[model samples]
Target: MHKPLLVPEFLDRARTHYGDSEAVIATTGERFTYDELGERADRFSAALQERGIEKGDRVAVLDPNTHYHLEAAYGIMQTGAIHTPLNYRLTPDDFAYILSDADVDAIYADYEYAENIEAVRDDVPTETFITNDVDAVEGEWESFDAVLEDAGTEYDRPEMDEDEIITINYTSGTTGDPKGVCRTHRGETIHAYLTVAHQEISDDDVYLWTLPMFHANGWGHIFAVTGIGATHVCTRGIDAAEIFETVREEHVSYMCGAPTVLNMLVDYYIEHEPETTGDAPVRLATAGSAPPEATIRTVEDEFGWYLKHVYGATETGPLITTSDAGRLFEADSDDRFRIKKRQGLAFLGTEIRVVDEDGNDIPRDDETLGEVVVRGNQIMEKYWGKPDATEEAFTDRIEGYYHTGDLATIDEHGMIAIQDRKKDIIISGGENISSIELEDTLFDHPEVSDVAVIPAPSEKWGETPKAFVVPTSGDPDEPGVSEEDLVAFTRDNLAGYKTVHRIEFVAELPTTATGKVQKYELREEEWEDEDQMVGQG
Candidate 1:
């Protein structure tokens, strides 16, 4: 007999085994056990069905890392609707594009961000708008609690296949226009299994929501942690001091973040020198960019927490490899730092290879740079509504592998070290910012004649977008536009995080013989002192 792997079973199993056990400790300081959370999810499912959300309908969640996100997501999936979670940091215009592209049927936004969605409501196909605090939010929105209460805790669960698409996570990445990455029940299920094994999630573990839930579904932690019956301690946003305090107060055992987050904690530790942990042991898994060797050492040696450096993209489950192998190096040896810096061996059931332009495997000399390609069950199924893009991503270098535009070197142990990016993407502070996107925005400025945006190493943000602008004045020293003005211009036009952090006036950008602007020259100049062009810690 064949059995299907449905994601809702994760909650079902918890309710069966640990129903009376605490499941979620919300940002509001409210707690819910597995049975209670299950009921809430059931009611939400009933409400969505009542609102005409049928099988395959897209339902969007625009909330922070709260208990509501979990309930809403499960609810959407329970009715067999696709769970599409948008980045909360995106602008109203961004939401408008995603909502229209996904053809979203309904949305459950946090009170704080509902206005952003409401601003573009008429432009999108989404008709139903629900928020946690309807009274606090302006305009028309049903209260989430009220809707669940009104609807009984019963709804028909459509027949599901493991291959059925259940979630769409949009990546507003190198292309500027966000492409919805479709994930299947099988892929997400396999990803959760792999995440639990690689990240070592446990039943008694107290997991903190330091990472955003919308991000690759919190890098698949929402499923991995819940499936493991771990306690969730939710937070509205990250505060280094508050995180440390939560570690003590809630006995948080495990969390995840990017290199930027690791740096923030280290900075806070150095400045304030607070107690690092509670009775429970702490482990942090970081991935957006590789952490510097120093930061890893500080986290392991000073903070008394284990740091697991990982590597992946939005399409590749964001957890294909981890640098947490302990058998390779001595326990206390300093050599562990170097080993831990590289994105370590591939997880079980995942195959990672560094291939050249000819699609041939590069030698494992730890020096030859090649594009990283992956083939795994955990990888996304395809880009929603973008067949050509999906086909190109899979067929670019090899027939069946997803070619990651990251340039890396593989060692004898098959450990990969990311060095540079082959794509025109700037990963600043763990967020993907397209160089062309920033360049296009800057080119729109009246005072700007020409512009090239590149990644500049930052101590705080790891990598920040730096623009080299040739002002209409044409003189490098006498460029009419001030740096402050350009920075503010970007903030006004785009999301706040995508703002250009630094601007340098240049006489002219370096160009190829055919007159194409050479962005590598600008990148080389910006990252002269760094070993890798990407963020380090």
Candidate 2:
């Protein structure tokens, strides 16, 4: 017998088997058992139904990493309304666009981010507003706690199918207007299962919320960790010292973050050599970009933690592959760091292919670059309300495959390493240069704390590679390394044709809510004066 893979099953199973177990450790120093969390979710379901949120309606939640988000998300999904999460860092106009685009029926914004919603209240179709602290908000809103207390724990759950869209995750509008990526219950369920298998999540593990739950449902750990009956320690935001302290105090065994988070931890380690781990050993899974090998080395050798470098897009499962399988590497091998830096082989039951422009597969020579295409059960159903865009995404360069738009090379072991975004790769004269390669080379320098490489307009070569270096000093004016010396360093390390044409010292790079450097922003600034972008025809 096959049961429909509904998302609510995760919480129901947790409440059944782990009712008395500690489920959530809120940032406000409150703790709740699975039973309590389930009751709260039930209360929310009742409240949403009373507020006229029918099945197939969209419900938006805007909050930092917090238990309220977890409660509200599960509550929304339990009612069969698509749980549409908004990035709290977005602007009021962006919130307006997404809220109006999704036509959300109800919303729960944290006290801090509620004002952004209030500013755009007239622009959205949402009528019922809820906040954790209602008085703290200026607009008409109901208290989450009061709503739950008034809403009796009685509501009918609608029958859900595996193919029903359960969640709508919006992409960061780096390329253009953010697209709502609609995912089915079956896709998310399989993604959670794959995450548990690859990341080795277990009931005894303690998970810290350094990664935002809004970002692909905390990279699907909201379901995976919950389904596994693991303890969740929620945080309002990320900080280096607080993370280490929480790891020791709460015994956080597992967490995931982007490469910027890795850089922050490494920088923190250098400045303050505090104890990095707790009584429980720590494993950090990082994605968003290829982390520098040196950062992986420090995180492993110095911080005494195992690092799992992963890769995927919001259109996919957001975590379709990881690079930390034990069987692939020898015991305590020095070469493992280099191997783990690559986005390793595909996850169980997922298909990853690097295809040329003609839809032909590239060789596994690890040198030829091609666009990464994937066909997986965990891929998104389609872009919400954009049939043409959905058709374009699945039909680009091939049919029936979601084109990742990431240019990469696959090694002999079928592990793929991302070279650059197809739009961001620099075509200097007639040759292609991987900006990731240049950034990785600069990352090895002792003074180069962080770096981002973008294609700057070139008078002769059409476009040339430029480096933005964030020096260890944290001051752009007095960067420890001179631009001339750094230029020589890249020239000595990389191919002669891939030379970095220029270097700019910067205090920090512009990043997205999930800590990915906004290369599109840089590209826009570089090409605003030019007629068109170089890579475009």
Candidate 3:
């Protein structure tokens, strides 16, 4: 039997088998079972079709982690339209650029973020603007709820090919304008299975929405959790108190976050002394940078939650590796913490290799750094509407591998540890220095809360490592650790050449919506005036 692997089939299965189970708990004080949720999704799909939206049309969604986002995703997929999710953290101009770039036909935005789209509405090609706010349907906008109310709970299902592009996810655009990454039904379906396998999701699990839904489709949790009929507890934003309260109130068993969110929860636990023990210990998957060892210890030891560190980019199903300590090492092993700190082994149905410039695999010595390339069904199909960029990303690097542009090393266990971004590597005195290593070491300091490391121009070393430190007290000028103290501290741990030569105290590090430190932003400022910012050595 040759069945098409469409994403909407996951929802169909949930509706058929788990109809009576609670499917969603919206932060807006509404709850729905799988049957009710599926009916709403079908109404949304019917509404889109009635409004003249056809198959392959682009439908953009701009909202926080809400049930509306979830419904819109399934509805769009059911209608055979490409689901495009915009980052709520982006500026109005950025939204404008992406809307035009993707040729978006319709958009479903939350009332909180509709103004951003309103600002750029006149400049884009969108034909329909739908807002979730039913009370205040002003101007040309239509109420999302009203549309669903007037529509039926059934729509004609179009014949879909597994290779059809179902979603277009935009990159963070740290270097330049964001590129839209194309994902087919087959790729995302494979990724959803992998997510369930890696995260150990089950029907009994209750998932909290700490991660944004717009970020790689919430790292494919929407499908993984829904496909298994797991409960989805939606949150409007990431708030420490609310998260703690929800975890206790709703018995949240599984969630995902970046390191920054983890740090916030740990800090909150330290200051407020929240109850750590629960009915079932929480399982959190964290990525978007290698979290400091201190964070892992605090999360597991103090908060009584298991932390799994995973790694990937928006291009590679956004999850290619995971460091599940319990599976990789003994509970009492001394090297457990050290091993968990590294990005773990390749995920199921994925192949990861660390290679040099010539595309040859590097030795598994854990010392030699190389670019991380991946080949699997989970990889994105291509860059949308950018042939040259797509070709540059996949060709001339490896025959079938996608270059991640992330430098890493593999240990004897075939576990990969990221060193640094290729452009972020500091070549000082003919020695390569990893900024992530320096930041990880600095995070061990008692007074340091957050840190970013960038290469600065130096007459002696051509380019030297500069540390930007955010203190625990949240004051830049009054940082408890002085420059001399930090310098001596680094000298005690790292090599002389890799030690940070300059320290700049800051209130907070600039981060993306997902909480990754924007090192390129800091690097540009430090090297703005230099004729050649890169090291000549």
Candidate 4:
């Protein structure tokens, strides 16, 4: 007997085992038990069937980290349809491109983004629109709540295979056109199991939804938490004040956020004291561009929160590696922070490798740089509607491993430290430089709050490294220091070519909703169709 591990199936199991247990807490002040969630999922599944959405259909969702977004995800999955979550911050053109590219059959959008989706509705292949807000929806879009109102609570579950596509996660394309990464039932199910094991989440834990649900299924925590019968406390947006309130009000024990989010919380704790019950410290799992060592210390010492760092991509089940630095460096505080900066080793059930340009394995000396590659069940099935791209992504840049496009080195301790993306590496005046390295060094400066490094057009040196900076404590309008002063500061710390040549002070750098800086956005404008494309002959 063969059966798929669609997420909706897990809902049924929870209903049978913990029907009365609290499953979710919405920022809107609504709570749902496991049984109630199951019934709503069934009703929504039935509604999808009525709209002619069935097995293998693609339904899109455009919303924040809300309860309805969660329900729509499971409901769409229940019909054996693919759940495609879009970055709500994307421009209308971005929205139009993805909607048409996926040929979505339907959309369940929040009221806030209803207009953006509606503007592109005509061009998109989708035939239905289910707004998240029922009362205030305008235009011809139907209400998502109303769709479930009269729908029967009983519906037939679709028969799906383990290999069937379950979700389409659109990667934040910092390099080129955004490609939708297709994930399968088997891939996600196994990922959920792995996340639980890696995070060590327990039934007594109260999981806080601080990260966006649109982000790789909230790093697959939504499913992992449900699988463990943990309670969910959802927040609408990432506000330092709101998050502090929720942490205390909901007794949030477990949460996950990017370094930026953690930094914000730590900053708030230092500047503004928030009332807390002091029951127990919260545990946080952080990744996305190895957090600064300062952040690691503040989160552990000041906020009284334990920090665990994990690394992955939208393609690799997004949980490929987690640092157990806590176990190895618990005794030495300084060593612990140093070890925490590395991406760490691969998780159980996954394999990783680093190889040279000639497809040879790089020595694990922690100095010889090579491309980081991996092969595992957790890898995406393929890029949706992109056969050539899929084939290219899987090529053996390494001997027989799927090229990850990331450059890294493994230490003797079996820990992998990601250096930078091969494409993002910079070469100035014949000197090769890791942009990430320069960025990290610059980040250590007290004046630099946020920084991104990119190649700028230079007549003499071909392409020189330029930095866009956000100041931590200074008049951002004046940048408080001259370019010469910054260059002097870098020269004290970094090599000659790696010094920041040009500095532009901005209030903030543009970032993906997940807090990843859109460096390519910075790149395009910096080059701006220049005659000699960066470092070209």
Ranking by lDDT: 2, 3, 1, 4
TM-score of candidate 2 versus the correct structure, residues matched by position: 0.99
lDDT of 2 at 211: 91
Better of 1 and 4 by lDDT: 1
Report every candidate's CA lDDT.
0.86, 0.92, 0.89, 0.82
* lDDT of each residue in 1-537, candidate 4, tens digit only: 866576766676777888899998987898999888877888888999888998988999999888888788888898899999999898778888998888899999999888888787778888988987756666787877778898888777877888889999998766567899999988898898888888888877888887788988889986888877888887777898888788787788888888778767766776787763246468888888888888888777767777789998888888888786566786446788888878997888889888898878799899889988887777899999999988888885743456778888898867898888776777677776777777778777767777888888888977888889887753578766666877788888887668878888888777878877777788888888797445331
lDDT of 2 by residue, 45-114 (tens): 9999999998899999999999999999999999999999999999999999999999998999999999
TM-score of each: 0.81, 0.99, 0.97, 0.95
RMSD of 2: 1.0
Which candidate has the top score in TM-score?
2
Model 3 Cα lDDT, one tens digit per residue, 318-375: 8999888476688766567687788889999899999998889999999999999998
Clashing pairs in 1: none
Where in model 1 is the C-alpha error above 4 Å?
Answer: 424-537
Q: Which regions of candidate 2 are displaced past 4 Å? A: none
Clashing pairs in 2: none
Write candidate 1's Cα lDDT for 1-537 as tens digits. 978888888888888989999999988889999999999999999999999999999999998889999999889988899999988877899999999999999999999899999899999999999999988888999999999999999899999999999999998543458899999999999999999999889899999998888988988988888888889899888789999999999988999876556766876787788888999999988876556566787799999999888888889987899888898899899999888877889999999999999899999999787899999999999999999999999999888999888888899999998765665566777887756557757866767766777888888877888999877666889888789999999999999989998999987777521123556667766788888867431
